[model samples]
Target: MTDFPEIAAANPAFFVERVLSVHHWTDRLFSFTMTRPASFRFRSGEFVMIGLPSEPGGPRPVMRAYSIASPHFAEELEFFSIKVPDGPLTSRLQRIQPGDPILMGRKPTGTLVLDALTPGKRLFLFSTGTGLAPFLSVARDPDAYERYEKVVVVHGVRQVSELAYRDLWTREIFEDELVGEQARRQLVYYPTVTREPFERQGRIPDLMASGKMFADLGLPATGFDPAVDRAMMCGSMAMIKDVAKALEGYGLTEGSNADPGDYVLERAFVG
Candidate 1:
C-alpha cells in the first residue's frame, strides 16, 4: 500500500494550519470550513488527508481522509464530520474552534465525480451519514442539471436530526426562485430514516427491494439501462455492498476514475 509522505513522516508542525469556522449540526455531527491555500485545487468529488496538531511541540498527529464538502469554486474548504467518542481524529477535532490549527494535505483525489459517469437522462445520488458530502458538491453544480434531465438524491440516516446539511441544502437550492424552477422540475430529494419515523422510514436497500422508492417517484423499478440512468453511492461498507448488489440486479455496472461506466461507489470513512 502507498503511504502518505507527510503522515508517514509523523510531523505535526509542518502540516498544521489554523481553523476558519465551525458549525455544529447535532451532538454527533458538525461541519467546519477552513482557509484553502492559494495553491490548493481539487475536483468536485475528491478527498484529502486532514489532521489535528497533537501537542504544542509533539510530532504525532491524528489524520484521516475527508471528502471535500464545498464546491470547487468556493474559496474555502469544507468538511462534514461525525463525532466518534474516541475516534483518533474526531475526539480532538470535534472541540476545534476558529483560529486553531488543523493539518491538511496538498492533493485531493477520488472516484465519485460526475465526469466519471457517462451522460444519462437521470442521475441518482444515494448516501447515508457523512456520505452525503460529495452529493452536496454535485447538486450545487449547475452542470449536473444540464447533463441529466432528472436528479434524485436519496439520503438515509439513522435519525431525522442526522439529516442536517442534506435537508438544508435541498430546501434552499430547490426553493430559490432563481434556481428553484429548474431544481424543482429536475431534482428530487428523498430522505429516509432508519431509526426514526418520518415521511419515509427504512434502509435504502429495503426501499429499492419493495419498489416503494420507484413507485413514489413514478419511475420504473426495473429496466435501468445505462443510457437513461447513472448512480453514485457513498456510505458504510454494508450499505455500499447491499446497494451495489441491488443495483446489479437492475443492470448497473460500477465505474471508477480509470473506467467510466454506469455507477460509482465510495466509502464515507475507512472505518
Candidate 2:
C-alpha cells in the first residue's frame, strides 16, 4: 500500500507516518506500529481512518477505520488488522514492510473509550478477534488502572495464535516503570480460543451465560453488579448486540461520551 510514490510524497490533510515494525501473528492477522505525530491527540480506546492512495495519480484514497492499539500516552501508534483475502485495502496492505508510509486520518474518534462510561469499581473490556485491538490500548493506559479497582479484559479468538499482544499484558506492562506494578495488580486477562484446545475455550457470551467466566474469576455469585461494574464491548455487530443485551439484563444501561452510564459499545464492522 505504501509503495506509491505520490502517496508518500504528500501530507496535506492527512499525516504520512513511517512504519516502525510489522509482526505477522497469523496468515489472517497481523499488527504494526508507526511513528506518531506529536500534535495528534486521542483517547486510548478510539479509532481513526487509515489507508493508502487510491491508485497511481488518483485523487481519492482507499481507507478504513482502524482502532489505535497503542495507549494515548505512548510515543508510537500501533494497529491490529485482519488480512481479508479480497479486502481492497488489506489485499495490498498485508505486504507493507518497515520504512513504508501509512496515511493517517486527522481526527480520531470512537464510543468505546473509558469516558463513555461512568465511574465504577470494576471495568470489563470484552472483545473478539481483531476487536481486541482497542482493549489493548485501554489496558496499557495508566488512567484505566487508576480509575477502577479491577480491570478485566476478555479476548475471544478462533485459535491460540490469534491471542495478540500476549507478552505485553503478561510481562512488559507489569515491568513498565510508569504503571507496571499497578497494572500487574489491577489487570486480569482471560483469553479464550473457541476452536482450539486451551484451558478456557468458549465465546465470552457463553461464558457470561453459564457463569463459568465469573466463577473462574471469583466474581460475585450473581455475576454483574451494575452498581459497581462498567463495561465496554467491541467486535462484530452480532457479538456486540449479544453482549449488550446481556449487560442490559444485568441492570446496566448503554452510555456515550455525552452521557456516561454503565456500558458502551462500538460496531466492529458495518452490515
Candidate 3:
C-alpha cells in the first residue's frame, strides 16, 4: 500500500510526483528532486503549487507556491525550500524522502520568466534567500545563454553556508558541453552575504550603488545601459522594491507576459 492514498493521482488536474532525492543545506534550508509527470510542462522560471496531504485520510491538502529550481530540460523537477518550524506546508515538506508522494499544480506560472523581458545584450538575475530558486532554473536553461551575450547572477544570503548550488553553477552547469563556451565567456557570478564576513559582503542594492559589484565583474560601474542591460528580480517585497527603484533610474520598465519590457520583477515570497 502507498504511504498515503494518492488523491492527486485520481484528480486529473494534479500530478502526484514521487520524491527522487533530498539534500540538506542547513537546518533552515533544503532542496529535493521529484519525478516529473510526463505531461507536465513549464518554463524554467515559473512557480508551482506543492504540498502534502492534509491528513492520511483527508481529501484536502495544504499547498504553497514554490519556484521550480531545476532547468526546463531536466527530466525531474527540483525545489529549494525554507524549512520553517510549524509552517503550514514546509514543516512537513522538509521530511520528504524517496518514494514519498508530493502534489504538484497542473499549471506553473510566474513573471520572473524570460518571456517577460525584452531582448538585450546582458541578462541580470538578482535574487536573495530562497528567491534564488527560480534563477537556478533560468541559469541552467541553455535558452538563456543563447538569448543574451552575457548572463550575470547576483545571489544574496545571510551567510556563506546558505549559498546553495555554488559548485553546481560554477562547475557542472557552466562547464556543460553544450553551453560551456558561452557560459565561460558570458556567465558572471556575484554572490554576497549580509550578516557574515566573506570576500563579498553587503546588501545587493548597496553593492550596486557602490559600483563594487560591477567593478568585480569588470563591467563599467556606469554601464547599466537601459538599452543593453535587461534585469529580472526575485526576492522579498522589500528587495524587489529596492532593486526596481534602482533600475528605474536607468529607465528600465517592469515587464509582464502581456508586454515585454526592459526589466521584470516578482516576489519570491508572499505575506
Could you report the Cα RMSD, in angstroms, for every candidate shown?
4.7, 2.0, 1.7
Better of 1 and 2 by lDDT: 2
Q: What does candidate 3's lDDT look like per residue over 116-152, in tens digits? A: 9999999999998899899999988888899999998
What TM-score goes with each of the models? 0.90, 0.95, 0.95
> Compared with the true structure, what per-residue lDDT tens digits does model 1 show for residues 132-195?
8888777766778888999888888999999977655567887754446778789989999999
Pairs that collide, model 1: none
Worst 10 residues of 3 by lDDT: 3-12
Candidate 1: 10-residue stretch with minimal lDDT: 1-10
The best candidate by lDDT is: 2
Q: How well does candidate 2 match the true structure, expressed as C-alpha RMSD?
A: 2.0
Q: Once superposed on the true structure, which residue ranges of model 3 sit more than 4 Å away at CA? A: 1-5, 9-12
lDDT of each: 0.82, 0.88, 0.86
* Cα distance off (Å), candidate 1, residue 244: 0.6
For residue 142, model 3's alpha carbon misses the true position, in angstroms, by 1.1
lDDT of 2 by residue, 1-271 (tens): 4453556566467888888999999999999999998999999999999987555656777889999998899899999999999998999889889998889999999998988989999999998889999998998888998899999988888899998888887788889888798887899988898898998998889999999988999997798999999999998777788899999999999999999999989888742
Among residues 3 or more apart in sequence or in different chains, the pairs in candidate 3 whose N, CA or C atoms overlap within 3 Å are: none
TM-score of 1: 0.90
